[model samples]
Target: MNGVAVGVFVFFFLLVTIMGFAAARWRRAKALDNLDEWGLGGRGFGTFIAWFLIGGDLYTAYTFIAVPATLYAGSAVGFFAVPYTIVVYPIIFLFLPRLWSVSHRHGYVTPADFVEGRYDSRPLALAVALTGLLATMPYIALQLVGIEVVLQVMGLQAGEDASWFVQHLPLFVAFAVLAAYTYSSGLRAPALIAFVKDILIYVVIIVAVLYLPSKLGGWDSIFTTANDSFNAFNKENADAIAAGDAAPKAMIPPAAAHWAYASLALGSALALFMYPHSVTGVLSTRSRQVIRRNAALLPAYSFLLGLLALLGFVAIAAGIKVENAQQSVPQLFEQEFPPWFAGVAFAAIAIGALVPAAIMSIAAANLWTRNIYRAFINRDATPQQEARQSKLMSLLVKFGALAFVLGLPKQFAINLQLLGGVWILQTLPAIVVGLYTRWFHRWALFAGWAVGMTYGTWTAYGVPLPGDPDSHFGGPLELFPGAETTKVYIGFTAFLLNLLVTVVLSVVLRALKVPEGVDRTRPDDYTADLGDEGVEAEIDPHEPAHA
Candidate 1:
């Protein structure tokens, strides 16, 4: 909490912003028009840039703060995020190249655009687009949460006696800068800034992990301290469950908890690419081989993530305390790191927020421009118009994320993010399954999305929180009694519901002689590579007359 450290962080934060805006000229694309150029970094990122950009976009500011916070909050389950990152790259290795192939082949910018072209169903594409937009908003908000925790730790926010608006001004300024640069520079800003962001993050985490152990005695002492605290906390939880004092059931046994960890890890690994921002990163690459090479290399970041999650244990051992579980990582750094290093750590956290927030805004805006604005609102829109509209929508999207950050309880960001996963998962049948085959009816996919959204929302609302005033309307559902099998991921659960409805409805719809949408894609299309598709020509239908 050194003011000098805070000043240093502020300096680096501004430095990144200057670099972000300057990226528009760095690669120096001939022109920055259309989704291809503005929204996808000219779709020409080389191996090195792609590695940092995708890593910065995916690992995110939230990862800087929240993952360790969970570890600090008394659950081994939080460590699930690390293994999930490891598992995710291999899974992406299987499908993402295909996705990239199809996207490049068809000049598709968003996954919903792929669905629209594949099935010739505007409604289905719209459904996918809306789901992406919904899922991404809270995610963008969580970036603000990352920055907020850093500011809180720095003692930059107004004291407890200050007005709410006064206390949160830094949060609002952070949002404003993110929105402005993203709108002006699109994906280019974050792509350039990712270099600085990743370097700072690695430095901060490596320094903190190495330096913090001595202050907390040793690794053995740290783990023993953390284990003792967690054990005591669990004992109280056990007593509450035995007394029927807590809602749902007890936390899973350590063994069963491992399954929950593996499942969550695997599920998240599968779902990560389905997110529009991650897809934007995937699609921005110059070739499928570039993506493949990066996939192998990207796991290197997971090693960093593993260490990042361990910081939670570090926090607990250091005896750092915060009212919010999300503050654990920041609090740990504030306690152990020097003022200057703390500033660098805070910059890592702040710049981390900017990278993903920029990409998420771009992804969401691309969806709006391609799927909604062009598909339904203006079919004849030009690439220039598409870029203009996306820029405007990017602003609105960031503002909406800011509103979510300011308007709701802190826990709402977490819940909404989980809810977002549920929403995005509904698109699996339309986006992922449609990649290989179109056996599933397009109409059936729409029905499935509808049912999944309903079930996921209802399930989320029915569960209650621990030690909260409102008992019945807080958290996700517990699936089995006497077991700690709560459904934190309503998306996976709802996807099953969606799949069931889709299968049953497909049968019913086909039996009723429903007119299925035209299928314009072939299996070969999914395997198409760069230089084969003429994506630039397809995206810009009207080439210049002089040319």
Candidate 2:
């Protein structure tokens, strides 16, 4: 390991920490006394800060490492990330502004708060809040995974027969710093640090894409090498099949792993908007126009993602082999770049983790305070008390994410994130439908959520592992064999099930003359533009700016 590269990473991390603390004063709120200022960056982030903040939040350390790793592992299907991100803008443009207006009007901090106010059902709000908190935990842990992998790649943990504790010291120190500043400054810490993280990430990805290919004999050579390796594996499998024997193990070569690649990409795209942190990013913006403008502009990051995905191909060309596919990108950079540059690349990955991890914790905390603690635990909780409870809860959430990384096996956390997508999508019927019209009955919506949750989990669990006797999420949903097939995404299927149940229940309840809850909003409220009297131009002092 080059000491110089390690020094660069340490130096950059410290710089980000200082920035995090300084953000507490950056916007100079009238008062940083409550969740409004602390949790949502005072919700006053203009176009530039919001751009960087959301970009950093959505495209995280895991994206940096895992996207390329999937590519290197021979699953081009992971490129679904690009298309899903592209798809998300239209969806956001449709609903987010309305959410912002209603949330702004009602002092709603969490999406669950919106559910409570709109549906006037404490149970629905609690359900949404609980879902947000559960879904966020593994995502934060994946960030820690990103940082830990970087430290491991740097050989910081490579001492001769070193204990696991000794190897993970740097990772512990890194998160401890994160926990401290986040507890002190809240969402401002991550928003401030995101600037550095995005810049470094862009530089590393661009440089790697250009430099690695030249050393590895260009793009054509890389593809050819991967194809050749893939064909050899396929031929061996075909021969085994021809001999009336079982097919060879699927090594996740580029050709054979296409289904995994496509499914992961598509599933992740749908799941991205569902993450609470992404919602926090959107809600923090100042206007509907800001969200629309950013939606169109954010595809620039997709271009960056495409370039980042090619690093996996670069690893294949370099013939870099490791037990974990995710480590290939960093290892490829380490092999090709000088010590200092490699350190910069590693720092880019590690810092990328911190931006999303911080925002996720804050979002989870808001859900707990607004929907759970306020609704169920203590209806009389004041804003100051709520903020204090949220701050404490945010710390606890971070520790929970840390436990996911340190306590559980890596695959378990990854799988949990996949399950998280299934869980969060259940909220879409309530959140998205409630944005436009409250025609759907609250009870029907709740019933739909229950059906979707059960069906999605059962389907995912029913999938069997490759060659295993059990049938539970071994792979994705396979509609037909050989000739007829669809292995796209299970969440999409679950969402359909949810919508189906909701619609059917709505009709049944309407015939029965069940009382539908009153909607706090009108038609004009959703399509309302900037400067409309219904929407507030400034963030509420009592609530968060992002809300």
Question: For each candidate, what is the lDDT?
Answer: 0.82, 0.79
* Alpha carbon deviation, residue 285, candidate 2 (Å): 1.1
- Per-residue lDDT over 364-428 for candidate 2, one digit per residue giving the tens place of the 0 to 100 score: 98888878888788999977888898889888998898878989888767767777888888898
Off by over 4 Å in 1: 236-238, 243-253, 256-259, 469-477, 481-488, 533-547
Using lDDT, give the best candidate's number: 1
lDDT of 1 by residue, 1-547 (tens): 5778978998998898788778777666656677888899777787899999999999998987877877777655677787789888887887888988888877789999899888889989999999999999999999988888889888889998999899999988888888878877778899999999999999888887788887778789988888888777667688675554553222222654555566566667767888999999989888888889998999999999988988988888888877888888877777777788888888998999999999999999999999999998899999989999999999999989888888988887887786677678778888888887787888999999999888877877776666654654354334533565433344567778899999999999889988887877777777777667443322231332111
Misplaced by over 4 Å in model 2 are 158-160, 237-267, 467-485, 528-531, 539-547
Q: What is the lDDT of residue 447 in candidate 1?
A: 93
Residue pairs in clash, model 1: 422-491
- The C-alpha TM-scores of every prediction are 0.93, 0.92
lDDT of predicted model 1: 0.82
TM-score leader: 1
